[model samples]
Target: MRVFQLGLLSALALASVPAQADHHQEASSQQAEHLDAGRWVTLGTRAGPVTSATRSQPANLLVAGDQNILVDVGDGTAGQLAHLGIQTAGIDAVFISHLHWDHTGGLAAILGLRAQTNAPPRLKIYGPPGTAELVSGLLASMVPGATAGYGVPGAPRADIQQMTEVVELRDNASVELAGMTVTVRNNTHYSFAADSDLARRFESLSFRFDLPGRSIVYTGDTGPSAAVEDLAKGADLLVAEMMDVDDTIAMVRRNNPNMPPQVAAGMERHLREHHLLPKDVGELAARAKVGAVVVTHFAGREVGDPAHLEYLREIATNYDGPVVIADDLDVF
Candidate 1:
């Protein structure tokens, strides 16, 4: 039930901001402006931090169109933002899909930015229920009542009044901001709130952002949830995850040796159920009529150079529209 004092002007203020991002602008023009700094860049998408295959950095994306809103925040995010000439505290909103370390580990800078800026606007972070607690705990762990550092020159404006608005976004649940409607939906996955008094799987979120003429959907993390089609109803872009078909199966085989022989038959079924398969994405796009589909969050196998890329391309057979296999900073 967190409320911002400026809710009445929320829409009007946002409306004053830019609605249509620079989608129609020429790449050459955009490139020239960003020549000193790479126009669209890649921050961190490497497989892992270790020599071992499983150790990999999390996935994240940033958009600086009309108003700045981050889609996700993962490891190396601080540097990435720095590279893009963006101030950590300057971000207006951070839209987290789910609370996986890979997706949000770099949030340290969020609070850090506030501390350095003298407790500016209580950053209005929007996420699931657990998000508020996480932000509070993280802030407390770093410094007690860091909010007290209330005034600093050139510091970010803080609004502690609306610390964390954990919007439990369900089907069709939308909020008005900047002349756009951000529609949210539940994306069911294996991840769930744990059995402890503290919920375990309460750590993830996905979203569909409808900004003016263009709409984009970020399926934070999901296997194959029908809710995606619903959330992405008519988005221009559907950014999704892609795990290797064979690699995933292999991992399951290694981890679960007690599987029945019939279990092998269910791999295909499970793949669709837990994650968005390449082919399935095409079908989803066509069915949902989203303008385009972009696949990212690549496993090493799926992202393997030219050969693996072609394999992923085959998945596009299911749909008829523009498809993008994402890199770090590929702007929409």
Candidate 2:
């Protein structure tokens, strides 16, 4: 596994450059004009399962009035929620995009913590077709913790089954939760695996939240998708995932110089076909005519100043509206 270790090291080394120090604070209080009620706070902005020192895994919290909706409960989502002073019991619902570890890792943690705190009897979770199975597995895995907590003083004694409500969804499904009409559309995240067994089992979803006087679309780790474009049309905010093509190529090369050409080609194909390039995100936002776009779910090298500007410039070529490069805990 030397190659894997080297790849991780290379990613960390490239991410360690001081140039990227500003990615964590780029939107620090300077752009408050876009901030309003129906708030959207990005809890973790990093892509994939690999956590970054500057950002947590992919999680976003949408707070509107008395409702709190969590989108994509990635690893450390519960911790980030606690860090933001949001009560674990206050989470109204959770919308998961896919079954990827990076997106669903913190589900058990959130549920367990909520149970431990005696927040609520049931956690409402909505996701794609396999969501029930995934949540069941997570709950089963947490049996030890749940059992151990039973003997503790004032601890919650509910079983995982009694504490979670998993709602499985399909493409074009619409549901009302927390006073918002949420529409789910199938994105191209899993299209690359069309021939695989997993393809038949699960799906990836993008969410559009129609809240009072405001609309937000979270493109949960998708490529350029026409369905997503239609769902996000004219949205007040589009929280989209973006990738740096060149940075990813360079990172792969740096980490796997000896990798076979075919393997490298395959990796590049996946990156290009499954993730939204900087320009693609711009084009999507422009086509959707979104009011503003918040770039998130970073899928490449660290987002430094120079790289951020380059990305913004590329996006500006197509999307003229506001574009904010979000960091962890940044709200809009």
Candidate 3:
């Protein structure tokens, strides 16, 4: 196994960093040192839409050669990018795993910032079906700003339509972009039956990125899934989302004290059915035979916390490969 370095921020420091801080200089310096390597930067590791002082939302930066692709633009992505000294205009493309808000919340910032800077047009955004609709809505929401560019009367407004191009992917879809072959497989994040209309209309996807010397598979957000396992087979790295079922449920209940029993039960069922547990990750990694695992999209405990150590132990049960409980900005 190859050695990898953690970000400058210790797990405890990362967990203690004020969520409101604009950026961390230490993290920025560490990221700068790694700018030349082909790596995955865990820009945001938190799961769900809930805010956290310790973690940002789900997002990742795939630095492959000269291409800077965003795997998932969750909320706070823009700010996180700033920490790495990356301008929004520097992004070459975006690959969205699913349409969940927590996964796509920062897309507006990406689009808006790029447009404002007059970056090259047609910033490609790839995702599952309905992606075009999502982008269209975001463009619509930006009309007011586009129409009033610099408060200059009659100045040519930035054309939102020309600023972005959306490609909607489907199960077993493949595309080549930025010198990488990106493939998608429908995962178990959504429970709808294959033949149902809802399933046709909505898809939760897992992606495998094959770059020059490395391959990384991202299990966006999913439960136990054969398709995901198949997609991740023999990859150099598997960047997966993991959940602590009980802790997530407790967090939800605490946040919504008024949540009725049925509602809470339903939410718990969804969490259990739509997300991966540590054991599930271990099983997937073991079955897929991935080279390594970097766990992100944290849902329960902060990395380095006592409980977080148990997560590694759980994964070690089935997979003996290296496992990392990633914190934000960690590069691998």
Candidate 4:
């Protein structure tokens, strides 16, 4: 697989300002050759620690085939998509794993790009629960000329992407797309967006795409949950988050005064309730009988030292399948 580098810009800066429009096009176009892959493309491929905190990679992603979908578009997703040489309007649907700013920040940018393109078709977006509102707001916020000539708006975009038919899944259910329905269901991952009071447990989600030759699961920012195993059963790929379990425990143990105890507790709770440690993920993949695994959504203390990678490797040992640490722009 080939990887491409995109110029630096914030999601807000990229969308709010218009001066960079030409730059987004020109800069992204240079990497066209690098981006032209056989089948799949990582429009934005960064292992994000949190929302809008990527210093190394973009969060937007593109999977093109009988279907064209953008997954978890993050802060620089707009520029990243441009860099990857994908037309925003041409995109069929956007599948957001969760409701986090970092993951969906470029949503507005993509819309802006659509406005710029003004193509024959619009765009359709699929998300867990609050997806429609987020997409609606994002679409409403774009500047007019952004996609006027490139394509149609909203619903029309769904037609070109092969998701013309709408299939609704139960809260924790799975559905397929493009002649193939992987599994999509809610998981233990919970966030403020899912719940306002933050007392009662909330619902986040993951998706498994079981294609003819490939089966992949995107564990969208989750904690340890058995639901994942149910969806990931026998998957060819597992795009999971990488929060080291030991690291999580260490953070709890350190309990520095600089760290807000409430925030720490909240984080700890989230990790406990919503995410998976590297080792735990490996075990899940192994138990699920997956063929290959790709881990992502890496938010934790710096893993620069060989120790972190070693930890990942150790955890992955549980799974007999091939394991790859997904960085930004790594295509499988």
CA RMSD for every model? 9.9, 9.6, 5.7, 9.9
Please give the lDDT score at residue 279 for candidate 1. 67
Task: Quote the positional error of residue 193 for candidate 4 in Å.
Answer: 14
| Best candidate (score: TM-score) | 3
Report the Cα lDDT for residue 320, model 3. 92
Q: Could you estimate the TM-score for every candidate? A: 0.68, 0.82, 0.89, 0.70
Q: Go through the candidates in order and give each one's C-alpha lDDT.
A: 0.56, 0.77, 0.85, 0.58
Worst 10 residues of 1 by lDDT: 1-10
> How well does model 3 score by local distance difference test?
0.85
lDDT of 2 by residue, 35-62 (tens): 2225677888888634577888999888
Per-residue CA lDDT of candidate 3, range 242-276, in tens? 98989988888889999989988888899989999
lDDT tens per residue, model 4, 179-237: 55656777766645544654133346688766553556777777777878888886655
Question: Which candidate do you rate higher for TM-score, 2 or 3?
Answer: 3
**Model 3 deviation from native, Cα RMSD in Å:** 5.7
Which candidate, 1 or 2, would have the higher lDDT against the true structure?
2
